[model samples]
Target: MRYWPIPLLLVALFSAQGANAEPIGFVKTLQGGNAVIRALDDSERPAAIGGELNVGDTIRTDRRASLGLTLKDDTIMSVGPDTELTLEEYLFEPARGDLKLGSRLGRGTLQYVSGSIARLQPDAVSVKTPTGTIGVRGTQFVVRVGR
Candidate 1:
């Protein structure tokens, strides 16, 4: 009887922990120009300005618009005007010092600055675009997307 109660308690505790754990990080900042920015979750709908961005969030920009994001590792990514991008994946594990970054670039320009995590494990960071993919190596660069 004691053993049964112990197992049941453990199960309940784990279930509760899983349910309350946040999926991923939240949007720290969002800036839009003449174009627009949309966070497809909740009823907020797509607006021509700024809003919260979460994991799996997608942003579309029209004529002359820009957006910037500060990731969990304090890495900065800025998108140029008339572009669309998605936050495909953003994960970090301080325990093992592992980090991963993935995004889908529809059409636009992106500038990425490697964060501390990149310095720690440069091989683990990657960026994906329509044409191909990019692997970071302690370097800062710009990417432009076109038809």
Candidate 2:
């Protein structure tokens, strides 16, 4: 009876829902012996200790903080003190895997060790900072971001 109105309503509903959708993934681990995770989203402010983590969710630490995360393909990454790292992208499949890690750095350090999957697909892993970008080449290194 009213096809135009129905289509417009459907589009608006879908767009609204999409706006609140959260990205999906898992939290491998929380290291440093005294680190805690805090959710920044409202849909589910779940505790993220070795649990699943989604987009729009932020993991934060106290004065003493550290974290070791194993991505979908077992890629290991360790973050240290007064730092904030966001899991921008985490994609893993049989044929290929891609991970984009972005860190505000704030005032701390981060050490990363690329996993076997990264060796096969070096382009799959990347870290972004205010200074520049760090591309993984199957090597281990530390990144410090601060004044």
Candidate 3:
């Protein structure tokens, strides 16, 4: 007799969850168990294959660790050991023609492969480092940052 309340409650719950729990990408490859994911609040978790990644998340790899991530728009990114890369922003909506990907590499090496976002809107993708910023133009590239 209370079916109406159940439906309304479910909608509210799912809406609230999706607003903040939507994962932007996932961890695809992990060479070692020394990788960590740091949240905006500074909390960290061990990086593992299939782990969810969100915007503003920082991925850190120890001396023996490496990680690979695949974004929602099929963009691929891999980082070598001792790397600190943060996903500064991500917005992908091809139908509406709104796409962007921004990342920051603090140190170490990173390999990036362009995705639909870069292909459709080449000017929307960028990678920032300590010394400079890189604009993606539907291609793959590697960058290293040193202290």
lDDT of 2 by residue, 15-70 (tens): 46754232344566565545545455544343356676644445555556666666
Q: Model 2: residues >4 Å from true position, as ranges?
A: 1-48, 55-57, 96-107
Candidate 1: clashing residue pairs, number: 0
Please give the RMSD to the true structure for each candidate, in Å: 8.0, 8.9, 4.5
In model 3, the clashing pairs are none
Cα lDDT tens digits for candidate 1, 100-147: 766677888888887766777887777778888888775588999997
Scored by TM-score, the top model is: 3
- State in Å the error of residue 144, model 3: 0.5
Q: At residue 22, what lDDT does model 1 achieve?
A: 36
lDDT, model 3, position 94: 82
Q: Which stretches of candidate 1 lie over 4 Å from their true place?
A: 1-50
Clashing pairs in 1: none
**What is the TM-score (0 to 1) of candidate 2?**
0.62
How do all the candidates rank in terms of lDDT, highest first?
3, 1, 2
Q: Provide the lowest-lDDT 10-residue window in model 1.
A: 19-28
TM-scores of all candidate predictions against the true structure: 0.69, 0.62, 0.86
The TM-score, computed over Cα atoms with residue i paired to residue i, of candidate 1 is 0.69
Looking at model 1, residue 10 earns an lDDT score of 67
lDDT per model vs. reference: 0.65, 0.59, 0.90
